[model samples]
Target: MDDIQPADIRLMRNEGSLRDFLRLQMTNGKARNAPAKPPPPPQPSDHTPGAWPTGSRPPRPIPQAPPGAWEAALHRLHTDTQTGTRCECPGCDPTTGSHPDAA
Candidate 1:
């Protein structure tokens, strides 16, 4: 018996030749020796310790407002007077016998 050369092996694998036979052999070999798929990932269960109940979500913590919030807001409003204008109403007009502080 003679040993086959690389050129001869390539020629046997050319189009419409022994290529399909070689591919089939490789596929069958892989199917026979491939490892089984790992078990499905563990699922969360109600019976499991520390597991949340089904169809329910964990409670979210309530947010708290800081102390003196109202006083801080009032301070901001009083200091932010860029839009302030003198009242010109008859009751509040300083020129119509009304004090400027009345406005």
Candidate 2:
């Protein structure tokens, strides 16, 4: 086993048989079946836009803020509280009133 044996090594260089060797290697190691492909990614707007989807109604538009009354009052109240002044209302915020289960 320790001796340099000529039979141990196949010293047949390229010898014009490279094409045959590659063809044999390729055909011998082929996958039996086609590989499983991954499922495609979800498309944007599976539900169409502009109008509502099937059987569902479009969402209602949010009510607009009244001209200049309540918003100004709330902002002033917030500013006054921040500056250490008392709330002028003397009661709870009526527009966005607190509730028992409110977060």
TM-score of each: 0.33, 0.29
Estimate, for each residue in 15-84, the C-alpha lDDT of model 2 and write its tens digit: 6655665576567566435466799877566656576667887778999888987766764554233346
**lDDT of predicted model 2:** 0.54
Q: Provide the lDDT at 63 for model 2.
A: 90
Q: What residue pairs clash in candidate 2, if any at all?
A: none
- CA lDDT, candidate 1, residue 50: 78
Point out where model 1 deviates above 4 Å: 1-15, 41-56, 69-103
Model 2 Cα displacement at 58 (Å)? 3.5
* Candidates' C-alpha lDDT: 0.59, 0.54
The RMSD (Cα, Å) of candidate 1 is: 10.6
lDDT of 1 by residue, 4-82 (tens): 5877668877755677756877898899899999998877554566777677788989877799776545443342134
| Cand. 2 TM to true fold | 0.29
